[model samples]
Target: MTRQLVAATKALLVLTLVCGVGYPGAVLLVAQLVPGRAAGQPVLVDGREVGSHLLGQPAGGPGWFQGRPSASDASGELSGGSNLGPSNPDLAAVVADRAASLRAANPDAAAAIPPDALTASASGLDPDISPAYALWQVPRIAKVRGLDESAVRRIVAAHVEDAPLGMLGQPRVNVLALNVALDARTAGEE
Candidate 1:
């Protein structure tokens, strides 16, 4: 009995040290190697932090192009999808409501509602919206900001980041980056 107890205690101590201390320490070291990414890739304006390009935020209003609906309310700490499947009536209802709101906000917009605009992304904190979605909101943003439609379109076009390695993911625009660029353009006009 004594021998078994001693062996069990020894195994417990070793596992605790490895899992609770060594594993965490190693993870911390690796995260330090990529500080900016691990720090959420903060977006800066005039040297002051405005937001992060890595996390989506609620930037509603006709003057701005919005990001995807966030099931987590864009909270990085609580980031996750709603886990509602496509066939779920609750999800369907939310999508319908989102579509209605989009139509009301952008009555002048001619583009069909983009899927990203209706469904919350899996991470719920995704910082980007599809170019289609961004362009779809161009008319409304232009009208509200009192800028020409072509100018808003040009800005959106300029910010369209190419897919990684030309194939990995879809072309995307960071909502915070796009909004910051818009702000800069708007400031230039003032």
Candidate 2:
């Protein structure tokens, strides 16, 4: 019995050191090897950090394309979904309100409001929106930015990112990248 207990103790210590300490240390080392990844791959403007490409920010106005409704209101510290299932009354009411607002803001947008426009992503911090959702806001963006709708659509088109390796997920537009491109295009036109 004593011999068995000694062997078990040794196994426990070995597993703890290898799985707990060594694995995490190796992970940190591997992560640090990537450029800008350890810091969330910051999005920069004018040499200043604007935000992280992995996180969402509040929409500026009708001129800017919006991402999904952020359940935590895009708060990095409170990143989470609303936790409300479909058919939950509270969720329904919120979606209704969001739909109404989208209609009011985008009266010229002929497409049906995309699901992404009314619903928050599973991660409240999702930085990307479906291509459909981004295009739906094009008319409003074009009008507000004083660019032709086709020009704004082209900018959105240029920024669309294909799914990873061509199969992992659907195409998406990173809202920050899209808005930055819009600002750059607008500045150049002036």
Candidate 3:
């Protein structure tokens, strides 16, 4: 009994140190090796930090291409979905409302409104939207920005990031990056 107890105690301490202390230290060291990512990939504009690429922002205005409907008010702090299942009346109502808004905003957009535009992502901090969603908003964004529709569409296309390694996820557009690029273009025109 004594021998078994001693062995168990030794194993616990050894495993705890290795798994808890050592593993975390190694991870921190590796993370430190990458500079911008280690520091949370801050998205900067005009040398001033606007937001992080990993998070979402409340991009409303006509000139901006909006991301998915964020349950967390587009801030990453309280990231989560609405928790309403598909059949929930409330969820349906919200989706309907959102679809109506999108239609009203982009009357020229003939494509069916993308699901990403009507529903919130599981992580309310989704900074990206489907390419279709981005394109759907191009007409409105161009009209608001006073730029040609094709030019704005090209901007959206340029910012469309492919799936990681060509297979993980669908191609999407980062709303923050796209808006930043739009701002830069507008500034250039000024």
Q: Per-prediction TM-score, please?
A: 0.90, 0.87, 0.87
What overall lDDT, based on C-alpha atoms, would model 2 receive against the true structure?
A: 0.92
Q: Model 3 misses residue 60 by how many Å?
A: 4.6
Query: Which runs of model 3 end up more than 4 angstroms from their true locations?
Result: 1-21
On a 0 to 1 TM-score scale, where does candidate 1 land against the true structure?
0.90
After superposing candidate 2, which stretches have Cα over 4 Å from the reference?
A: 1-21
lDDT of all predictions: 0.91, 0.92, 0.90
lDDT string for model 1 (137-176, tens) is 9989998999998998899999999999999999999998
Q: What's the C-alpha lDDT at position 80 in model 3?
A: 93
lDDT of 3 by residue, 1-190 (tens): 9999999999999999999999999989999999789888999887999988888888858889888898889666788999999989999999999999989988989989999999998989888999999998888888888999888989998999999999999998999999999999888888
Best candidate (score: lDDT): 2
Worst 10 residues of 3 by lDDT: 70-79
* Clash-forming residue pairs, model 2: none
What is candidate 3's local distance difference test score? 0.90
Candidate 2 weakest lDDT stretch, 10 residues? 30-39
